[model samples]
Target: MSLPTKTRQWILASHPTGLPTYGTRTDTFALETHDLPALSANQILVQTLYLSNDPAQRGWISPPSQIDPKRLYVPPVQLGHAMRARGLGRVLASQNGNFAAGDLVQATLNWVEYAVLDAGDPAAGVRKASELPGGLSVTHYLGALGGTGLTAWYGLVEVVGCRSGERVVVSGAAGATGSMVVQIAKGVVGASYVVGIAGSEEKCRWVESLGADKCLNYKSATFEADLKEACGDGVDVYFDNVGGQILDHMLANMKQHGRIAACGAITSYNGEAVLPMKNYFDVVSMRLQIKGFIVLDFMAKAAETVGKLVGAVQEGKIRVGEENETVVQTAFEEIPGTWLRLFEGGNQGKLVTKL
Candidate 1:
C-alpha cells in the first residue's frame, strides 16, 4: 500500500456559545486539505476508520471565557487546529517499535483522514484493538467493549457497588453507556428490578428491550408521576447520565442510603448554565451517596473490567448492538455534521462516524 501525501481535516473555526452548528453559514468548523509530512522517529501514521462523537466534545470546544480554569478536563481544541476526537484507525506506517502497519488501534485521531502520533505520548492513550473471543466487532471497542461499556461497568460495579435485588434506575437509558448500564444492572448484578428514563417513547421502548423492567418517557407531561409510580418503593441505585431536572427527580425518588453515579450530563452540555439541584438536600436527609466518575479514572482496572464484560457478552447475559448503537457512514466532508447530530438527539445509543 502506498501512503498518501495529503490528508483532509476539519479545523476548528470558532467556538460556539451554546449548541454547535456545522456545515452551515454559522459552522464552527472549516474543512481544509493539508500536506501529510513524513513520520519522525518514534512516530506512527494512522488512517482513521471510525470516529467517536461524544457529549464531551461540547466542553472541548467551549469558549475559554465560558469555562472555569479549575474545572477543565482535557484542554480545548485550539482555533485553526484539527478538531479533537477519538477514533479507531489502522496503522498505515510506523517508525516506532511498538507499532507496525496493519495494527488496529484506538486513540485520539482527531477529525482528520490521517494523523501522525508520537507513540510515547501519554495523552494519546493509544491501545491496540483486537477481536475478542466472543466475536465482538472492532467497532465494539469504541462502544460496548470500550469506554461505553467500561463507563457503565466501572460506575455500577466500582462506584455504586450494585448488588442483587437492588432497584437500579438509569438516566439517558437508551444511550450507549446508559443502555449498557441498564443491561449490566439486570443481567450482571441481578438487580430485582431496573427502570430507564429516556426522551421519547421510541427510545424508552428500546431501553425496555435491553432487559429493563420498565422504561419511562421523560418527554411526557406526566413524566414525574410516571417515574414516581415506577419506583414504587425507592431507587437503590441511580446511574445518572443527564444531570439536570432528571437528577432532581431521581434525588426525590431515592431509597435510604441509595447510591448515585454521576456520569456525563448531556442535558447540561449544551446549556449555558447547569442549574442547582432542587432536591439536593435529599442527599443529607436520605443519607444518599453521590459519586462522580470518569472512565479514565479506572485505567488500572481496564483489563479486569473488559474481561468481565466480555464474559457476560459471550454468555448472552449482557447484550450489545441491537439498538445499542447508531453508526453513520459518510464521506469525510460530512464528519462535522455527523458530530453535531449528537446534541440534536439524532442518534440512539453510541454515535460513531465511519470515515
Candidate 2:
C-alpha cells in the first residue's frame, strides 16, 4: 500500500507559564506534500483517528526550573518538536508482516493526522490492530480499554492493593482514570464505600453515577468537611489523581496501614505553590504507605490487565460511561490553542483531537 504523501501535525511552539496555554504552548504544522520515508522491514504507516489530551501531557512539558526537585515528572516538550501524545489510528501502509493496511492500531502517534513508524518503535507497538469487538466504539479503545483503563487497574489493584470492604477515595473523580478507579474499586472489589472528589457538582454527580458511594465537589468551600463526612470509615486506599491538598486531606484521614497510589498530580501541575501537607505525622503513626507509580512501570502487564478490563466491559459487569463532549478544531491550524485549554481546566473527560 502507498503511504500518504502529506500529513498535518501539531507542534510545540513555546514553553508554558504556570498551566499550559494552548496557543502559547502549541502550534500546528501542515505538510501539504511531504514525502513519506520508505518503510523499513518492520514498519507501518498509520492514519490517526483519535488523539488523547491528558493532564499528564501538561506536566510533560513543564519547565524544569519551575518543577519541584523532589517530584519532577516528565521532561518539558522541546520547542519545534512534534507534541507527544497517545493516539488510536488505522494502518494505511505496512512493511511489517505482523500488521497490514486497514488494521486498526494504537500507538504514541502524537497529535498528527499521519505517522510512519517501525513496529519495534517503543511507542508504536500494536496491541490490537484488527477484529474490533462488536458494539464497542473504537474511541473506547483509547479510553476505557486503553491507557486510561489500564492506569486505573494497575494503580488500584497493583499499587494501592485495594481490597473488599475497604473504603477507597479517588481524587479527580470525574476524569477518565479517576472515574474508572471508582467503578473498578466498587464493582470488582466490592469496597464498603467508594468516594470521589471532582471539580464541580455535576462532575461529583457523574462520579456517583459510576457507583461511587459518595462524591464530593472539591471546588466547594466545605470540601474538607464534605470529604470527612463522606468517608464515615477512614479511607483504606486513596487513588490520588490530583495530589496537593486532596492528598493532604486524605493523609490526615487515612486508616491504619492505608495505601495511597500517587498517580498524576494534576492539582499541582500549574506551578502554583503547593502547601506542605501538615499530616506527615499520620503517615508514621498510622503506618500508612504512600507510593508513587508511573503506568509505564507496568507496561509488561498491560495485556493481562487490558484483557480483564475488556472482559468486564464485554460482560456488562462495568459501565464505560461516555462523556461525549468533543472540542473540534478547524483544520490543523488550531491545535496549539486547543492544547492549552487543558491547563485552564477547560476540558472534561478525554480530550481527543480529530484531525
Candidate 3:
C-alpha cells in the first residue's frame, strides 16, 4: 500500500498557563497537516492505532520555564512539536530488518497519524502483538496488559513488596493503573482487605467491581470517615496515584512500617499548589516506607509482567476494560479535552484516541 500523502498532527502551540486547555488553540496543542516524508534506512513508518492520554503527558509537555527545574520528570515537548505520547501502531512500511509491514508495535509515537521511528529510541524494539487468547483486544498491549499494568505491578509487587493478608488501600482506584493495582492486590497478593478511593459513587462502584473489598468517594462529605472505617484495623500497603491531601490521610492511617507506593501525582500535576500534609510526622511515628518509582525502571521484566497481567485477565481474575470502560477511545482531534478529563477525575480507565 502506498503511504498517505499527508499526516494530521497536533502541534504544541504553546505551553499552558496552568493545565492544558481545550478551547482556543493557543493554550496547548494545535492540529496541523504535513506531507509524508521519506523513510530512511533503519527506520519504520507506523500509522498510529491507539494513543494513550496520561497525566505524565501533561508534565512532559508543561513549559520547563514555568515548572520547577528539579521537578520535571520527562523532557518537555518543544513548542511547535508534536505532542509527546506513547501509543500502539501498525508498521505500514519498514526499512529495518527487525520489523516489517503489518507488524504491531508500541512506541513513543507522537500525537500524529504517521511517522518514521528509528530503532532504539525511548524504548526500542517493536513488539509483535500476537498469541493472545481469542477475543482479547490488542489495545491491552497499551493498557492493562501493557505499560500501564506493568507500572501497577512493578509498584505494588516490586516497589512496595505487597504480600498476602496485608490490608491495602489504593487511591485513584477508578483509574487505569490504580484499578489494576486493586485487582493485583486482591488476586495475586490475596490481601485481607482492599479499599479504593475514587471521586464519584459510580466510579467507586466500578472500583469495587474490579475486586476492591470496599470503595470510597473522596468527594463525599464523609470521605475521611469512610476511608477510616474501610481500613478497619490499619492499612498495610497504600498504592497512591493521587498525591495531595489524600496522601496525608494515608500517611496518618497507615500501620507501623506500612509501605506507600507513590506512583502518579494527579493532584499536583498542573503546577497547582500542593495541599499541606499535617500528618507527615506520621512517617516517623509509623515507620512508613514511602517509595516513588517509574515503570520503565522495571523494563528488564516488562514482557514477563505483561504476560502475567494478561493471564490474570484471561483467568477472569482481573476485571479490566480494554475496549470498554477500562479504556476510553475517541477521535485524535479530541485529545486535548480527553487528556483534560484525567485531571478532572471522571475519565474512564485509560484514555486513548483512535487515529
Per lDDT, the best of the predicted structures is: 1
Model 3 CA deviation exceeding 4 Å by range: 22-25, 66-71, 120-125, 322-329
Measured with C-alpha atoms, the lDDT of residue 247 in candidate 1 is 94
Query: Taking the tens digit of each residue's C-alpha lDDT, what string does model 1 give over 152-256?
Result: 999998899999999999998888899999999999989999999988899988889889999999989999999999998798999999898899999999999
Clashing residue pairs in all predictions, respectively, total 0, 3, 0
Per-prediction TM-score to the true structure, in the order listed: 0.95, 0.89, 0.93
Which regions of candidate 1 are displaced past 4 Å? 24-26, 272-276
lDDT of 2 by residue, 1-355 (tens): 4457777666666656565544433422322324567677888888887677777877666665766534754455666767888777888888888887888887888767788888876756565544446555677666777788889999999898888898899987777788889889988878888988888888778778889988898889999998888876588999988888888899888889999999988767777888988888999999999998888889898888888987787776668644623444435666655656655556555556666
What's the true lDDT of residue 185 in model 2?
93
RMSD vs true structure, all candidates: 1.8, 3.0, 2.1
Comparing 1 with 3 on TM-score, the higher-scoring candidate is 1
- Cα misplacement distance, residue 235 of candidate 2 (Å): 1.4
Clashing pairs in 2: 22-336, 22-340, 61-76
The CA-based lDDT of model 2 is what?
0.76
What tens digits encode model 3's per-residue C-alpha lDDT throughout 285-335? 989999999987888888787778878877877875553344556787786
Residue 326, candidate 3: C-alpha displacement in angstroms: 4.8
Residue 69 deviation, candidate 3, in Å? Answer: 4.8
Model 2 CA deviation exceeding 4 Å by range = 1-3, 22-35, 67-76, 131-134, 324-330
Clashes of 1: 0
